[model samples]
Target chain A: MFEALGLMVFYENMLALNNVSLACGDNQIVGVFGANSAGKSTLMYTLSGIMEDIAKKELMAGGERITLRGSINYKGRDISHDKPSKRAKAGIILCPERRRIFPESSVLENLKIGGYLAKPAQAAETLEYVFKIFPPLTKIVRRLGGFLSGGEQQMLAIGRALMAQPKLLLLDEPLLGLSPAIQYWLAKSIKEIAEERGVAIIVAEQYARPIMPIIDYGYILENGSAVVEGDKDELMNNPDVKSAYFGA
Target chain B: MDILIYGVINSATLALMALGFTLVYGVSRLPNFAHGALYVLAGYICWLLLNRLGLPYILAIALALGLVAVVGGAMYQLILVRIRGMSISEIIASYAIGLAILEGLRWGGLKGGTFTLPAFLEGSVDIAGVSVDFQRILVVVLGALLVGLLYFFVNHTRLGLALKGMAQDERAALTLGIDSDRMAVASMALGSLSAAIAALILLPLGSIVVEAGYHVLIMAVAVCIVGGLGSWTGAILASFVIGFAQILTTAYLGAHFQVVVAILAIILTLILRPSGLFGKQKELEERV
Candidate 1:
């Protein structure tokens, strides 16, 4: 339901995203695997229209001249130049890397704040659903977001994004620094969320082993380019992906 | 007993003055130096409506507040939005707007401490054997009420929660569909409204003079700096600290040392704490 065509992002003279194309169908989990500095975060930002904001801020501050060349068609609307809020309202929400939860706000407050665009009834229902999905959050509902563990923060981040009622959720390194057990468990929960909520999820990660089993389709990014793209099984058996990602 | 009674009133006055400045900074990090100008602007507008236009007091206060809110939002929409990422420019632009408003009023015949708004009530009551005017009592009552109302609004309401989110992290707020520009506009309007409220109650104690505008700005900035910029609780607490200090200074070291006390509070906070009470980012270590 969401497709980005020939996405190219340039920071000053360096190409951050070099003519990469990606698409995800409804209710699908698309994993984009890449090592560090492989343009995964850049692509995620470009998709969520955050790059436009960054570009604007940089230009206003007379910093780097960021160049974005792409057409993102979401649900048949060309939203390449829309603001992040506009994109979010259009059911595109990005759960950013590092889980930038409001440090001072309580966990419940963070979730409620995420429901900014939702109607009161929708927000209430989503709050219930979020707690149901992330059970640990229910116990620590009163704890400050800053005090949460890394795994808890990731759950809160995803739950917070779910509160935004996204049809296409962009997960940027959801399991960056988690233990393997939590990573796999969280990956399973992500798949269930996709299947149950019917929201398409695009997870960009460096560690592919945990998320690989849950994704339907995947892309392997290397140095700002998607060098390999295929279904999950095809990717697991591919020679290049195996060597780089699977360590086979 | 006198110092205690007067100290509470003084702190309330300082809190009322700094609330708007801290709020706008809290939500969007926009240092609205025109906060003082807006306070004077509200009083002057109300004076014009009540006297020049012959409107009722209630209607005049309401209309003045509404107009100030519009001006605040418009200031952001027209000028500040254009210079959004640079802090120095934001301060300069806002302070310049403040100068234009205060000096423009001076240029337009708002001179020499003659203009004053009538108090909502006109009687003094003896409180614990001390004679206290009704307007000063009203300032304290309204100030406390405003703080409670503002706390409820920010914590309970959706827009307020959205604003709080924006204050914590702008980009994270963005992904949740909370538009920074829109929230900033809302913050400016709300902040300006608080400034007008302070003007309505406190301006009656003295006069709606242009000099008071600059004085209010200095006092507000001093309170916010000591309280930690963008931290309202810190602002209120710092107000009490500086407020009592100012009152004590006025009582003991002559009234002329009151302003000196406020300025001294700001410098000392910077030297010692640096981030005020609740301010983040300048501390030795922060939350993980």
Candidate 2:
């Protein structure tokens, strides 16, 4: 479960997400469609507590607050106030944009660090679980992330996030920079992660068609706000959504 | 044969110092200028415990190392941590602080008083017509063992892997739930601790002086730069190369020019191969 009440975030003097609010029930895949610079990444960063200090002060001043922001609850006990590390322990893991894999480290090393969120003992089981989802990763676990092809690095990044056993997974532009074939494969894997694990997701993306098959709900982020929100069918056919996002 | 044995000792010493330097730079991305302070402090601490306090040799050594570890850790947090997100000024300030500490010890000691190591193992051992001091041999063996242990700790243990990950990408490591500040402190402690060990071996080599850490630290900078900043393998290989170069220079040109030649070598390496002999070029795409 995830909820953002009037969640407003901003970078210095510029509003990114203004009074933006959304909610996702357990295991729901909520796809956020927006043009470039629509604050999708900032929204994900704020939700995951990775919002930098510069943007954090601006967002707090912009009167935007994340209420009950994590998997636990929305009223008060939520991890909105928790540090990034604590939030991760609370199972609010984010697969950041650009993959953000430790480039110099091996694939296994990246996965191992992700496993540190819980405990060392659970690593083997986590590794096995992750490998089941992305078997290609198991073969290249020893290779450095920098050496991995773009598609492979994306897999490793998402797989590393899975190793954390996140209850609420935030995928930021997973399909960005991916080829059509690889994008299809990654979308399938992401759907499986959300469906099989019941891991709630809030993915931010420019391309909506690839994620439309898996996403239960959709929110269209306009200039600085979520101008439209509904079930996939309703929002997919909305005139504004079609023109601004799908270029229909 | 004697020259070769001396070269081995030289290599071992250079490796020991470079290990500490590289460990600090690897994680912090800043060359810890205070590391030399730790080195010089280690010797002074040992001297005070052994000669002034009249403690037994073994006890003194342990106390000195433990003391330096605590002091090093604290100083890193107080001074180094203040400049955590700042620019290269942190490194410059750290070096200044280190120099200040060394000079303070010297000035505090009244006209750079004599510094000497406790006569732990003074005898010499002759091997195949090559006479080497027992202490120097011990330093070589013990240094190798320490470096080996450090290598194992960094490469084998889970905590070590976490630490190496932090060095690789601090933000990503933190996102994985590793407390990066804790890792940094631990890394600094280990780096300073290694400096302490090198100081222990360095005691017999020369008299104790605050300035004693200066040259050794300079040598470490050369070795680390030549090897590569974050590459442990590079640091080790460069240490051997520099160590042999130093010995050859000392034997042929004389001791006074050894330091100059080493400095020249570091500048040349920095110019020729800025990425280091073994280090990868820094990826500029991340900042964008």
Candidate 3:
């Protein structure tokens, strides 16, 4: 289980995430939905500790002054000040937006690279499971990651993250720019991965229709704050959620 | 036959000189201007171990390489680690360190043509109709073997693969628990080892001098620029191109024109293809 309390992030004078708290129980799929600039990515980055890295880099480069005030607790241990690599070693992996696959590396190599923290036996087993869950990756195993289609790249990205053996996987816009069919299929696969692998997932997306069915609990983010937090049926019945997300 | 034999020999020498520079830049994007200093330091250490410490030739070489690797790693941990992510500062700091090392060696009496490493083997062999010294032949053999070994290491080993991943995407690698600073240190050590190996084999053909350090730096930079910075395959190919060019320039024009050919190659590559032959960063930027 993972819990974040009173998360606030600011870039100079602009607030990216304001007083947002999120929690993910074991073997549960939590969805955070919002339109553009709703702080979905900011929330994910802050959760995965990448925001700390960005803040460091920015400060070093004298670019921006980023302030982060939050406490991230993973099963009672506070990982608020942990570096991104340390967080990943603690089994918190982020499958970033745009499927940032190593474009030059082969599909298999990308997956292998993702297994940097796993033991040999664990890596091998997870690699096999990745290919099993995303069978299309098996067909183009030798293809360069950049050459793969968007759908295949997304699958590879998820598979690559799975290779990291994450306890809490963060999927940020996994279906962005994807066709409706592939989006539905990926959503289904995400559900199966949670149920089968028992790995907790927190997915942040703008398109809610496809992801809404699979999530047990969801948060609707507007601006930089959580506007609504409820189970699936409650959200579907809400008039504002209906028009904004489902167009009902 | 003479051109063919000499061209291959020249190509191998360039390859050996540029390998460490490329490796450092490839993994961590560190220019490592001290690469040449490390090369010269390795030779001096080998000389010291052999003469002053009364060690055997093989043992001296091995110890010298190990020392250089430690020094290289320490340099990263102590200094380069602070100024990382700033390219200009990294280059300035590294170049300053390189200057101190080279000049310090000169101040300590590393000059003169007296310091020469013994050839690994003593005999001339004929390739085609051209006769070449055993030392030059050793350079070619060792160069090819190093390249092959490096290829295998980067593609097959876990640390090497993690380094490759870091090279491609630092953030993505970080998300997989590959610490960038640790990889940078590892790469520096490996690069230093490579420079020492190159010195052990190549310094036998000529005396070790401080000037050779600066020369090696310029030659490595030239080869990297033409080959496309941080690209291994491109570096090897560009070495062959510039190697043959330098050899042919020396053959026809004058021996002094050899360095001119290298400088010309750098300028031409920059003007025509700023990204070098195999560099994809610029191309990707264009697409985006």
Candidate 4:
């Protein structure tokens, strides 16, 4: 279980995330849906502790000033001030937007690299599970990550994050630029992963059609704030949610 | 036959010198100007251990290497860590450190040609009617072995895989719990170890003088630039290209032209490819 309260992020005078609070329970899939620039990625980055790293780098380079104010509680522990690597070691893994797979490395090597924090036995077992869950990865294990198709890259990204043995996995726009068929298939896989591995997942996406069916609870983000929050059936039946997200 | 054999030997020597520099730059994108200072420091440490402390050759080499690795790690943690992400500052800070070490050694009377390490095997062997000294043969053998070992280490080991991931994408690696600062320190230590190994093996061929430090740095930079900065395979291949050019220059255009060839190679690579051979040209294009 993880909870983020009153999360606020600012780039200079512009607020990227404003007073947003979200939580995920054990073995649950929480969907955060919004259009472009709705602070979905920003929320994911802040929760994953990557914003701290970005802020540090920017300060060092005398570039933009990024301010983050939030408390990320993971299983009764306050990890707001923890470094990104520490957060990851504490089992909060973020599969970033655009896949961000290691371009030059082979798929197998990319997966191995992701297993940096896992015990040897855990890594080996998870590696097998990853290939089992995403069987397409087994066929192109030797291909360079950059050369893989978008769908394959997304699968590899998810597989790679799973290799890190996350307690709470953050999927940022996992359905972006993906075909509808692949999107539906990936959504199904995500559900299975949560049910089998019992890892809580928070997927942020703009395409809500495929993801909406799988999520137990969901939040609709507009601009930088959460506009609506409810369970699956409540969201599907809401008129505004239907027109905006489902396009029905 | 002489040219062929000598060319390969020179290439291996260049590869050995540039390996550390390339590795550090590749992983952390930090151009460690202190690399040359570390090379000379290793030799000086070995000399001190051998002569003053009365240690055996193997023991002295090991101790010297260990000491340099610690120094390299400290260098990264204390200084390089602060100025990271600022390339100009990183260069200036590292270069200043290098200057202090090299000049400090010179000040401490490391100038003369009196300091020389004995070869592991003090004999020459004939290969295809060409007699090569054991030291040169050892350089080639060890160079190939080091390359193979490095490939295996990077591919099979967890630390090395983390390093590769960091090199490709720092943020992505961080998400997997690979600490960038720790990896940078590890890279610096490994780079320093490679420099020390290079010095231990190559110093046996001639006297160990402070001037050799500057020469090694220049040659390493030239090799890295021509091979493509931060590319291990590029460094090796560029070493062969520049190595044979240096040897041929020495053979035909007098020995003084050896350094000229390296400088010219750097200039030409910069003017022509800019990114050097095998560099991430697409990345540059994307940035531009």
Candidate 5:
């Protein structure tokens, strides 16, 4: 299991996340649900080693104690000191919110860059895999990223990340600003990515409606803290979650 | 007519250097004010090797270009890379380094006495019935070739397209796993290399001086701004416009005010077409 214990992250004067701890196994898809400004992104950032903080950290794969303080532990290895690029090479990739597609580049160039850390030949194969998942991208490989519609760009963004062949995919608000149809399309794609690739996922979203059913485990965040954490079904029906998210 | 041809030739060289400068800025989001120093230093280095070390012309030029690339790469790593988070300050600091380089070259050149290089190609060629220096033809041809190659590189090649992608969205580029640092270094080296080529061509135009790059530096800046900073074609067209202006001003207004006229033209362009003659609003990406 990959986990974080008693993690606290601060960005300057802002307490972005406080005392957060979570765990997920390779077979489980962990969903992070919170309202806007509930520190969902910060939690993901802290766990991904993109956030700096002061905390007593301990991460363990099975029984052995691993020091993951102010860092991320991937597969019993402390990847805290690794740069984001290196961490990415180690199969830990963040798709990030907003679907940050290099808008001036062609769609193919976007995918080519995703496989940049891997062997060039392997990267080409990965590019083909990415294209297979998003076939529309194959036709528009020459089209600039900026010219694509929002839905296309999001698909391209996720497709680009998939090119890395990540073991742990940290997706931050993949559905943000997307139309309902596109959102569902992406949600299905994410499920397919998880099941077909056997990639562990930590998807942070504002609501559980679209994502919770597919997740094996879940955490409910409120004001920079995880208030309710449990199995997806248990957390979905929890009273606090209903009151917070559904406003019931 | 000869002077006008010279202006056209010189402007082509300016456009060449400015194109590189603009590309570096577009991709790296840094002004690269050290570009002027790169131009002047390349000329000085080439002159040193050719005249002092007695090296062949092509060898000297190629060696100078290679040196600038190394120095440029090192400079970016040592200074710009560390301050990637500091955008405005980096631009200002690069200019400061450029000033320092200009001062050093001026001081060194004065102490060492006059510096000069024999024409690499030598003699004059008829361009549109005008008696043009062969080096002028070489400069134009080389400049066009470099621009064409650069266009292909950015438009067609893997690395060039990658760079263009980086220029579009740095964060997105990083997410794609493009090593932004490596791209930055390569862009800086190429920028310096472009300037180095300009220096090689410019050196034979006149005797070397410490402040020789100042005029060209200003021209580079003006051309970039007028060409629509990120547009390659824009830079080329703007270079010709400035080149013709320089020639006309030198003929009618005199040498003293040639630069002043050029500066005025830039100002006029800025006032009239802020996005540049070729600058479209769409090419600009969101960055602070």
Candidate 6:
């Protein structure tokens, strides 16, 4: 299980994420729905400890000042200050937005790279599992990552994340720029992955229609704040949540 | 006969010199201007071990290479890590380090062409009526072997694949538990080892002088620039292109025209194609 409390992130004077908190239990799929600039991706970055890296890089470059204040509890440990790689080694993997696959590497290489922390046996098993789950990837095993289509890239991204044998998978806008058909299909696959792998998943997205059915718990975020939190039925049936997030 | 035989030898030497520089730049995007200094340092260390300590030649070479790897890794971890992501600072800081090392040796009384590593073999052999020295032949053979081994390492091995991922998409690699700093350190060590190996093999052909340090830097820069910066295959091909051009110029125009050819290759590559031959990923995408 994972939990975060009093999570606040600021970029200089502007608040990017304001006291937003959420949690997910083991083998559970939690959804955070919001519009663009709603701090959804920021939350994902913070959870994965990439914000720490970005802030350090920015400070060195004399660029935007980033400040993050939060406590993330993963299992029984507090990992707020852990480096991204450390968090990854602890089995928290982020499938980042826009599918940042290794452009020059092949699909198989990308997956192999993702298994950086896994033992040889674990990596090999996960590699086969990935190709099985995302059957389309098997066809483009030798194709370059940059050459994949949006749907294919999304699959590879998730597949790559899975190669790390994640305990908690953080998916940031996996459905972005994809067709509705693939979005729903991917949403189904996400549920299947969580069920089969028994890994907790925190998926942040703008499209809630397909995502809402699979998420056991959901939080509606607006202007960097989580405005609503409830079970799937309670969130879907809320008049305000329906109007704002679902367009109903 | 001279052109063909010497061209291959010269090309292999260039490849060996540039491989470290290119590999470091490819993985960390850190243009280690200190590459030439490391090359010279390796040769100097081996010479000192052999002469001063009276160590065996093989052991001296191994120790020198190991020391060079440690120095290279320390260079990045101590200095380059701070200025990383700012390419300008990375260049200036690394160049300053390189300058200090190269000049430090000069100030320490390493001068002239008197210091030379003994060749591994005693004589030369004739191939197709052309007499080729054994040392020069070793450079070519080792160069080819190193290139092959490096290619295999980067693609097939776990660490190499991780480094490749870091080279292409660092944050993506980070989320997979491949630390950027660690990868950079590994690259610097490997790059430095390659530099040392080059110095060890090629220095036997002639004396190890301070000027050779600067010359190696120019050759490396020219090769990387002309080859299309981060592309491995491109660097090798560009090395051959520039290498043969240098040989052809030496044979016809004069020996001094060799460096001129390298500089001209850089300028021409920049003017004709701003990105080296394999610079643009979109162009490579067409092949996929």
- The lDDT values for all models are 0.94, 0.79, 0.93, 0.93, 0.76, 0.92
Quality of candidate 2 docking, DockQ = 0.43
Provide TM-scores for the models.
0.98, 0.90, 0.98, 0.98, 0.88, 0.97
Q: How far in Å is the alpha carbon of A99 misplaced in model 1?
A: 0.8
Tell me how many clashing residue pairs each candidate has. Answer: 0, 3, 0, 0, 0, 0
Which pairs clash in the backbone of model 3? none
What DockQ, on C-alphas, does every prediction get? 0.83, 0.43, 0.74, 0.69, 0.28, 0.65
Order by lDDT, highest first: 1, 4, 3, 6, 2, 5
**Candidate 1, pairs of clashing residues:** none
- Can you tell me which runs of candidate 2 are displaced by over 4 Å? A53-75, A78-81, A243-248, B52-55, B110-115, B119-122, B283-288
Worst 10 residues of 2 chain A by lDDT: A66-75
Interface CA root-mean-square deviation for model 5: 7.7
User: Tens digit of lDDT per residue, candidate 3, span A53-141?
Assistant: 89998998889999999899998999999999999988899998777899889999999999888889999999999999999999999
- Candidate 5 positional error at B20, Å: 2.8
- Candidate 1 segments whose C-alpha is farther than 4 A from its true place: B282-288
**Candidate 6 lDDT, tens digit per residue, B1-288?**
988999999999999999999999888888999999999999999999999999999999999999999999999999899888999988899889888999999999889988999999879999888899899999999999999999998999999998999988788888888999999999999999999999999999999888888999999999999988977888999999999998898888899898989999999999999789777645543221
Q: After superposition, how far is residue A64 of candidate 1 from its true place, in Å?
A: 1.7
**C-alpha RMSD over true interface residues, model 1:** 1.1
Candidate 5: residue pairs that collide: none
**In lDDT terms, how accurate is model 3?**
0.93
TM-score of 2: 0.90
For every candidate, C-alpha RMSD to the true structure in Å: 1.2, 3.9, 1.3, 1.5, 5.8, 1.9
User: Model 2 chain B — which ten-residue stretch has the worst lDDT?
Assistant: B110-119
lDDT of 6 at A222: 91
Candidate 6: list runs displaced more than 4 Å. Answer: B281-288
Question: What TM-score does model 3 achieve against the real structure?
Answer: 0.98
Question: Which docking band does candidate 6 fall into?
Answer: medium
